[model samples]
Every structure is written in C-alpha cells, then in structure tokens.
Target chain A: MEQDLSAPGILTSQLDQAIGWARKYSIFQYPFVTACCGMEFMSVACSHYDIDRFGAGFPRFSPRQADVLMVVGTISHKIAPVLRRIYDQMAAPKWVVAFGVCTCTGGFYDNYATVQGIDTILPVDLYIPGCPPRPETVLEGLMLLQKKIQAQGRRA
Target chain B: MDLAPILSDIEALCGAPLSARGAGSDTVLTVPPAKARAAVEFLKAKHGFNVLVDLTCVDYQGFGKGTQNVSPAPEGRRFKLVYRLMALDAGTGLIKARLALDSWVDGESVPATIKDLFPAADWLEREVWDMFGVRFADRPDVKRILMYPEFTGHPLRKDYPIKKRQPLIGPADASARERLSPADLRPRIVE
Candidate 1:
C-alpha cells in the first residue's frame, strides 16, 4: 500500500468543491419561529429578501423532509423541550442556524419562560444575533452554515 | 358597597366611587371582594364593564428570586387583583376595576369569588392563583400556569435566586462535571 502525501489535501479540495456545489443546490429547511424574528424570516422568504438567489427556494414544513433546522425565535422553558426533540429527529448531516437573538441567546426575555440560548439544547453551527435581525443577516448566516457544511462533506 | 340603587340607571353608575378615579378613557372601580359579583352583574346588566377585557394579578411582595415570573408574588396577603372590562356597546367607553387582595395567606380571609358573575373568571382566577399562590375560594382549577407543575417555589416573589449560565458552556473541571452529571463519572467499572 502506497501512502500518498498529497491525498489529504486533494480530499480537502474535493470537499471544498462539493461544498460549492451544495451551496448552489436548493436546501430544505425547518424554521422554528417563536417570536418577532419569525416576521423577518418571512421577509427573507418574500420578494424583499429574495432568498431564492442562494438556491434555498422554498422552506420545507416537515422536519423529516428538511436538511437544515433554522431556529428563528425565542425558545422558552415550555417550548425548548419540543425544539430539542425536533432537532434530534432531523436526519444526520443536518445543520442548525440559530436565527435571532432570542433563539441565539434569549434576547430581552431575561426570564424563566425563555431559554437563554438555543445552544444549551441543540448544537448550533451558526448564531445570528439581533432582537429581530434583518433578513439579510439571516441569509448571511445561512450562507456561512452552508460553507461549514461543505467543509464536513455534508449538504445543508 | 351597595350599588343596588345605582343599578337602575347606567349613567348614574359611573358617578359612583367605582368610576370616580376615572383615569384616562377607562372608568375605574374599587370594589370589596364580597360585592365583586354584584358589581359585575350591575356592570353587565346596567353599566358597561361588559366585555371582561382581562383578569390578571399584581404581586406586591416586590421582585424576587427563581424563575422570571412577575405576576405572582409569595406574599400571603399583599397581592392585588386587577379586572379590566370594556363596554361592548360601540358607542360606550372602556372601564377597569382594580381590587387589592391578600389571598396568599392560608387562613387569612380571602375575598369572595368573582367566578359566579363571570364564568370566564374561573380561568382567569385559576391563572392568578396558580402563578401567585393567591386563593380564589371558588375558582374551579387552580393549577400551574407558565411553569411546570412540579416547580418548587413561586418565582415571582422578590427572593427567588437568579442564576445566569452561558448557553452550551461546559464545566471546566471534575467538580463541574460531577455537578452536571447524574452519576459519578470518577467511579470506574472493573470488568
């Protein structure tokens, strides 16, 4: 068996190429919106934000059918449990983009009802912070998560 | 106390002590617990506090520890009950009556039930009682709202502990690990 010194770099380059292809492909995502940020997510999906440019055309409704999990609002104590279960149910090679300050860190709801951040419950790849972030910010985070997924040879 | 004579005329009812404060567009009433239902009857049948806008609580024990619960206070007799009502009549205005009660005390006399007049009061009263530990003598279901049923203490009280932990932050050492883990990770399994 010959040990090739450049094989890892080639694999990495191939992985990068695969990620570029994935970024150009449509991504099915489950949006978990609980608060004001959900409105911005709507705006991104609308003509104003125009998410179609990134190849993420329509957001999927069912978790079983989606490749990305987008947490778009506040996760409360009552709701966090459900969110965790949903994250677990998503297929492997899945990516999560925490899409608002409330979802990323509980925002202004400094109380028991709201979870401080989604990371405590689910492993988040990207954290998008804003009381209700601009749709552009959400799209940017989505793009970053796609890049991260490419590095892992996964489709987001 | 006796709104009986005033009931005959709806306009005259507003002139009573209930609406005397008359803050903003909403008329106000301060009623004792015993006559709460009667006041509602008069308002619905005569004057217009008819809509039953909202029934909520105000904890007077100040801000305290535990969960981020504000509406409920642990103080036995220092809680306040607020009832918001509106005139269903398109032309009529809005009204609010705020009643102060100390129903948190186990034996301290709780004001009579408002549920009889507004069956809707049942859910609202239950919510207040569940959150604030206020006793609404006649409210049918006084269980937990906005908190787990097994929740230890009333969070809205001014003395509950406040702890802020950064999300997804793991413990730094073995002590932290032991604190977080259900079993002693240090214990070895000898096969």
Candidate 2:
C-alpha cells in the first residue's frame, strides 16, 4: 500500500553514526579563557590558523548554546565554583577540552590559590598539553575530540 | 628628594622617634603600631605621598632559624605590617616611602587604617586583614577580599599547614547556621 523510501541503490547507516557525524562536524565551543593561554586560543580561532576548517570556530559565550567547553587557562580555587556553575549550566551531550598545561594540571602553581587540575571540578574529555599549546596542537586536540565523539556515538 | 625633613616632620607629628634604616632615597622608617597612622597621615598630607602603593603583612615566625639566619622578633610581637607609599609629583620623578610597623600582631595591637587620608588604602587594608588576620580599627568594610567568606584561618599565616586542602562543594551562605572550622574542614593526614 505504501512505497518504500529506501529503494534500489540507497545507502544505509546506524542512527548513532549519523548523529555522531553530525555532532562532530558542528561543535559550537564555549571558551572559558582566564589567563595567558587565551592569546594562543585567539590565534587558533583566528583567520590564519582558521579553526573554522574543522567546524569549531564559532565561540558561543553562553553555555546553553555550546557543545564543547574549552577551559583555556589556570583554574584557581576562588574561580573553581564559577567554572563548575558554567559546566553545570551547559546542555547535555557536551564535551570539555583542557586547553593549557595549567588547566590540565595547575602548571607550576602548586599553591593554595590554584586548583591542582580542572578534572577535580569538571569531567575533562581531552587535554592539550602545553604552557599554551601551539595552534597545530589545538587542531589535533579538536580532531581527537571528533574521534572521541564518534566512538561515544558507536557505544551509545 | 631629601627625606630627612619629612622624617623629622613625621617624628614631630607622631611624637615618637622612628627607627630609620637604609640610606639616600631608599630609607625605610620603622614606626610603632600606635603612631603609624599619624605618621602616615602627616606624610600623605604634607610630604605629597599621595599614592598608597601597597600594604602587606609579614609573619616573623621561624626567623633566626633554618635558611634565613636573622634576629627573632620581640616577645608577643609576631607580625610586621609594611606600607609602601609613592609620591608621583611632577618635579620629583617618583619617590617611594617604606614604613614598617614593628611589634605588630593580629587583633589588638594591629595598626590603625590610613584610609581617611589615602582612599586607596581601603582595599590594601582589607587585603591585609584577610591574609594576616590583622584588624584595622575604624575600617567599616573588613570582610575577606582574597579568600571566600566561609574560608577558615588565614592561609598566609606561618602555622597554616601547607598540604591542607579545603575543597568547598557549594555556594556558601553568609548567614548559614552551621559553619566548618579549620580543624573540622582540614584534610586528614594519612600515614
């Protein structure tokens, strides 16, 4: 009684793969830039390095609209609550990238003021290790995140 | 600029002789806690020390021991409050005045605030109060500036445990009935 939508030479794939592919390609990032690493983040997102090629150039300031949280610098104990609040506010199906060595492990700030690592406050997906990672390193980190998204999709 | 005249003026105004150290433009005046405010006021009003560059507190604990071999502080006088004042007059390129309040302590013997004379001393005094537990009398707003309100014990104190971690979970209410003390909140020392 009804015509088949998938006829003849139609290619089929799992819903998870389709969703994963879509999600990976269009990652709207929310940059929680605090310190010096912000300069590197700017360079990576700007025209020369062009993070847009990977479809992650648009930096959404609001957490609600963002799919990825790129923590770009040192997270002090004083600022930890603020970081946690922003992470909690972001919609589900979100990922976090610790952009700098400071964000990854508090760098050399082994003091009362600095939080040892951001992972203690928020779950981190990937860590791009550098004082401030080069633009290429950031791009690689983005690619890794894409792969992670794809793998997570398969598992889901 | 000659600081002898200014030093004399400060000594006359405060009615106490200040122990001066260093020579030339880098003179440091060690004023008693009781007369620090008056001396600072005189310097600000007359000597053109308009900018309150910095106000910081130092704990003389464990002095004359370990790596730093220096003379220990006088009995019951554990702290020293240092005030750095700068005069940015057009004629004189930049004049720095260092005032040290020796025989100072946290609560009762702490120096008075110079916020009335130099408005910039407000935040610096608040910071000193926050870090060293030093009370600035006549300062209306003495709340903690660097550390959170719920934070117990000043971190900068010499006795504060270095590895002690205080991880706060949620937003702290100012008027919360139950508050955790330093002993209760400190991390358990594992063997």
Candidate 3:
C-alpha cells in the first residue's frame, strides 16, 4: 500500500442529507419542569415566545419519543429519582439542556435537598443561565442546537 | 368547632361511630385506621374538602410528656398522623384528620399508603417517612428521597444533632503535592 495519507476528511452527500433530515424534523422535548422555572418554560410554549419557530413545537409528555430533555427547574433530592426515571425513558441520541440557574446549578437552595446541578445524574449539552431564563434565551439555545447538529453532519 | 353536627352527618351515611377533636385550626376526625380511606372518601365526595394539602406525622415526645392530648396512649402512641385537606371549589372549607400513629400490631405502619386515592401522596408520604420515620406500608420506592442513599441520619427529627465537619475526602492540599520530590511523582521500579 502506498503512503499518501494527508487527505482532508470529506463530508459525503449522505452526511449532508442527514443534517437536512435533523433540521427538518421537530424536536420532541420532555420538559422536567418543577418549581418557579417550570412556569417560565410554560410561557415559552405559549403565544408570544412560540418555540415552534425553530422546529421545536410539540412538547412530548411521554419520554419514549422525545429527542431532548429540558430540565427547567431546581431538582431536589426528593424528586431526583423521578427525574432520572424520566431521563432514562427518553430515546437514544437524546440531548439535555439545563435551563435556568436552578437547573444548571442549584441557585439559592444550596441545602440538603437541592442538587447542585443536573449533570450529576444526566449528561448535559447546553447550560442556559438566568434566575429563570426568558423564552428568547431558550429559543437561542434551540438555534445553537441546530447549528451543532449541522456541524456534526453525522450522528455518533 | 361544630363536631356533633359533622359526626352525626357522617354516622347517618355510615353506621360506624366517628369522633372529632379540636387541634388548633384543624378539626381532626378520629376513625379506625382501617376505615381511614373510607372516611377520607366520604369527607371528599360528600362533605367537600377536595384538596389534599399535606399528610404528615408529628412525634409528640419533643413537645414534652402529657403536654398535648393529640396522643393519649403511652410509649409508641406518641406519634400523630395529620392529614390537612381543603375544599376545591366554592366552599373552600378546610378539614383535618388526626390518628394516633401508635401501632397495635407488630410490623405494622401508620397512615397506610394513601397512594391509591392520590398518587401525589407518594412524595408527601416519603417526606413524612424521611423526617418523622413514620412508616407507610406498600410505598413503591420507600428509600430516602431528600437525603442521599448512604446518609447516616434524618435531619428534621428533634433529637438529630446538627454539626459541620470536613468531608471524608477533604479538598486537595496543594502544599502536600509541592512537597513531593521529583522521584515521588514517578512510578517506582522494583529492582
């Protein structure tokens, strides 16, 4: 075998097709909402901030079909197992976006019950920070996720 | 406050006797533990009090011996099972049920799993179990919820001591690392 090994990694047409498919498909998010931040997540789903603009319309009540798990509120130790069960039920290639200061880091509830972060239980890809983040920030995170998918071009 | 009227109404519906007592703002109904679910159902369906606010237990020992009549029995009879309920719609009236958590039968637990009536009681019951150590029979995942699996003791109990100390694995002492010679960093080769 000849030793010409300096070739650039090429993205095939099939890889481009995969990226297109990911963008066209809507993200079914299993929102593990509790406490104050949960209310803000509901606002994002409502009229003004309609999250559907970024192909993330339907919030799936069931975890089996969901593509993303949005942990929107503070996870206390009491509810941590419940949250884990919900996360485990979601399909593969599932991404977790830790929404708000409470979900990303336990916020002011640095006591026994509150978990410092969602990452302790599940692998988190994105961190959105705010006491309770606005709907616009959530929409921005969705756009960032779409860009990340486009960059990967192929699923790992 | 009007215990007689309510007890008479309940007796009319179900022939079994019922008793009522005053505990602060709560009108506590004392019924046989076996009839607890039936009593709650009658109170909710017929007498209003739709919302189940909280279900918890209080250990009367901390309050002092013979201070409160909430528990009349001695020894293990000191625990009280408190169920707070509220009307859902127009009435908005509140009612409570207080039962002596004193177990007569061996290996038996109190306020027996209200999960069948309200699944939301699962967490509330777990909280009671975690704090007061009041056992709820047939709880699905009855493990400690607020505390880690290996946590030594419950914090909420009156007797539980609160103290702060360094964790098992204390923060890395950088000075200890710096004191180590170059040879110490490298793996030792046995001759």
lDDT of each: 0.61, 0.76, 0.63
Kindly report which residue stretches of model 1 are placed more than 4 angstroms away from their true locations once superposed: A1-16, A154-156, B1-20, B23-26, B46-48, B62-76, B90-110, B162-191
Error at A88, model 3, angstroms: 3.6
Docking quality level of the chain pair in candidate 1? incorrect
Any idea how many clashes model 1 has? 12
Candidate 1: tens digits of C-alpha lDDT, residues B1-191: 23334433433433444333344444345554455555566766655455666777665654444657664434454565677765554553423332221223322445566777777877777676666666666544567766666555556544555443222222212122212122411211111
Candidate 1 lDDT, A36-108, residue by residue in tens: 7888888998888788787776788888888778888887776766888888788876778778777665666
TM-score of chain B of each: 0.54, 0.77, 0.61
TM-scores vs. true structure, each candidate: 0.71, 0.84, 0.51
lDDT of 3 by residue, A4-114 (tens): 544543446566767656753567888888878888888898777988877787889899988888898888765777888888888776778888877665666655456
Name model 3 segments beyond 4 Å from true: A1-14, A17-21, B1-129, B133-152, B158-191
lDDT of model 3 at position B150: 54
Candidate closer to the true structure by lDDT (higher is better), 2 or 3: 2
| Candidate ordering by DockQ (highest first) | 2, 1, 3
lDDT for B129 in candidate 3 is 75
**Tens-place lDDT digits, model 3, residues B1-191:** 33455567665655666556664445566555565666667766765656677777665554644655453534555556667666556543333432221222112355567767777778887877776677677764687766666565555655555332111222212122212233422211111
